[model samples]
Target: MATLGFIGSGNIGTNIARLAVAAGIDVVLSNSRGPETLAATVAELGERARAATPEEAARAGDWVVVSIPLAAYEQLPVAALAGKVVLDTINYYPYRDGRVEALDTGKSTTSELVQEHLAGAKLVKAFNNISDFHIPSLARPAGAADRTALPIAGDDPRASADAADLISRLGFDTVDAGPLTESWRFEPDTDPYAMPYSAEPDAMRAFWAAAGEAIRSGTAPQTPPHVDQGVPLTAARLRTLLADTPRKLTADRLVA
Candidate 1:
């Protein structure tokens, strides 16, 4: 089994670890606080799980998952994560991450910023749109009629495909939402962000289709629109991390 390391084991990170362990994957979990502080989480995950420092967790896994807030991206050890397949499950929340002038000005995407930091890792964007309350509830059999679909975006074809396969094995379908640049389509303010994973896939697709149609027809409700493009996660000493990249393919090949 591949070792899964999580750099920040909070709600989404812990839940991903739980799901991975239930599926028989070994997990190395860590948080910003320290391994000693993650005792309860490691204990809850049993023998398949262990606690380690952030860098140790990054170094331990075949695939590393970065689930910390965007503000703490610099704290992630980029050198240790070199050559690993990284799953970025973070989304930008201006209120929580503080304001990134670029994001505020519709200039960049959060995933791009993280990618710039982990220059040696094959980064894929996923798990960002769904809320913590819905993650566990979304799991279903691979081909179950009501299975959920999770979108994954990234630059590397193999990495994205591998992520899709792992996601399917973990009980959901994968929708390739395009490159890291297109990840904004699935960001926090978009319909796909929080509306679909907890519901049926078909329903979710229908929702996006409708939203697109509405946007084209000028029937969409006036709400805060999703920032139109991807942004680098950070610009200076204080910033660096976050979500997905896209794989170019026929429109039909977009979803798994």
Candidate 2:
């Protein structure tokens, strides 16, 4: 089995590790907090998973996943990740990541910044648009009636294809969203960001309506109800959503 390394073992990272383990892959998980902090997660993942430092994880796997916060991109070990195929699952949230002048100005995409940071790595933008909690919920076997497809972007076509193949093994299908510069097609707030995989827009709207009514009536729960199930997204459907989206971020909404 192939080994997968993770540089961040938060919700999405651990979930991806789960899927990879299920698909017969070994996983090395790490986080900013250190490997010892991940003991519980490693135990839950069984024998195929182990915890290591970020650099060790990067160097140990044939392929590595970089799922850290966008602001921390510069902290990635460039030399360790050199010449490696890296799957980037980062998205920018100005409020949370502070602000990047380029992203604010539409001058660069998140993956572009990451690729620039990991100059020698083969970077592919992926898994950024889906909700962390919805990953395993939406994955389906290849060619299944409800297989979900994700969009990936990278400058190198071969790297993108390899990423697509690896992601396929993990359960979901993939659609190339062009190069890293074009990756914003699936980034935060875009048409394809979260809805297509969560549920159809109509379904989401209905859920919101009911939630609003419950809130207004003072009958809402402490937490909002999750959409009952996800709607599968086909590659063609994902392509159309990506095509229909026009860049929404314009001038940099600068922050202090």
Candidate 3:
């Protein structure tokens, strides 16, 4: 009877909640907009989920996931999350999050900034690389040969192991990508970003082409499609993709 809490009930947050509940974990979801706004989502998740204020969600979790915009990191409830293992599914997008000087000069990885703001929390960078649409579609039963392995990076080994276990229970394997500093490897525009788990390169490209256009034109759909279960990525393959690759930043990484 474990409970997972969320600080943002947007794309990534809801998807992870769905997976967690499906795995028998209860979820407490909150957003910047407030709990009442999440009524429909709570109903959709059934009895295993409920909506609360951000502070309540922060304090309620056995382990919490913070999937908010990176710009809002410092706004998180620091006291509530002080000693918790916080999973960060946040990435830096200049256009969406504005410019961050430390990131601009390569002095900080996104999670490091999050960790610094949360102080005593054990933070792990995770669930950030994959597209939210592909999340549920890609999840497979444990021990399934084709189960995809997501990458996680943390400064603490024990916390990383706990996070890895969380990912496994939600139906994915995990590959350790060293410390938080190395998290940049799987960010947007990198080899392992969201493309590999997309199942088919063409479908991923087509959906993004249409979706990105819609977003830019101010009409993006609420749910992304073409992901009827992506390719099952193995640990070996993911390891190869995680090799010593340099970061590649571009405006194309803007994912709103």
Candidate 4:
């Protein structure tokens, strides 16, 4: 019933747009390359989808998803996104994003930086941990046995709740992982980063904890494990994993 606008229509953006359309949400897609480059994606999403400039998409969306590289956060249209609910799906990779002193020094998290740029917008961090390739298969209708859960972090309670509802409509439950500062828990290489989980919350939690332990100990399984991609997990498991996970210094995390 709502229109979802995307500032970056790459792998994660396009896949999320597909899910939004499947949920009966219209989508306006945009990218730095120009609206023309999004023709195929808009067509694939059918009548409910259209292509537009980043600013246009920002103005058109009920909720705007900013999935662009972390380095490009400053380029987002600030005025157009004013007072909008923004879903931030950015991750920092020094090699890819070059060096961002704020991120490198742990002065602020990635979502915090985006929030600073779009000062009037309500920013929520989510969908960054999962791989685009696993999204479709991992989704399940509400109450389905195989439904999965995703984590979201934000400073605004209302905005966070709205984001959780949207995530549910997209076929996954939401776990409030505190404020944006805590988002690093689900960032790259963390326990809950890209690990798949079961429809059951408990199972999903367990999977997160196990995965976290494995990663810290250097025993995490390679992608495409013997089993299928979406692994089952529980909340209790995730808590345990988070407890066991050692907090790395910002300097150490930035090295790679």
| Strongest candidate by lDDT | 3
The runs of at least 3 residues in candidate 1 whose Cα sits more than 4 Å from the true structure, single-residue gaps closed, are: 198-256
lDDT of 4 by residue, 116-214 (tens): 888999999988977676677688788887566777899999999999899889878777888888777777657676653423434444554565455
- RMSD per model, one decimal: 11.8, 4.9, 2.2, 6.2
| lDDT of candidate 1 over 58-88, digit per residue (tens) | 9999888899989998778989999888999
Residue 106 in model 2: shift from native, Å?
A: 0.7
**Candidate 3 deviates by what RMSD?**
2.2
On a 0 to 1 TM-score scale, where does candidate 2 land against the true structure? Answer: 0.89
* Candidate 3 residue lDDT tens string, 134-197: 7888898988877899999999999999999999999999999989989888877678888888
TM-score of each: 0.76, 0.89, 0.91, 0.84
Which regions of candidate 4 deviate over 4 angstroms? 196-228, 232-244, 254-256
Task: State the number of backbone clashes in model 4.
Answer: 13
lDDT of 3: 0.87
Whichever of 1 and 2 has more TM-score, that candidate is 2
Give lDDT: candidate 1, residue 187: 70
Give the poorly placed runs of model 3, Cα more than 4 Å off. Answer: 206-225, 249-256
Candidate 4 weakest lDDT stretch, 10 residues: 220-229
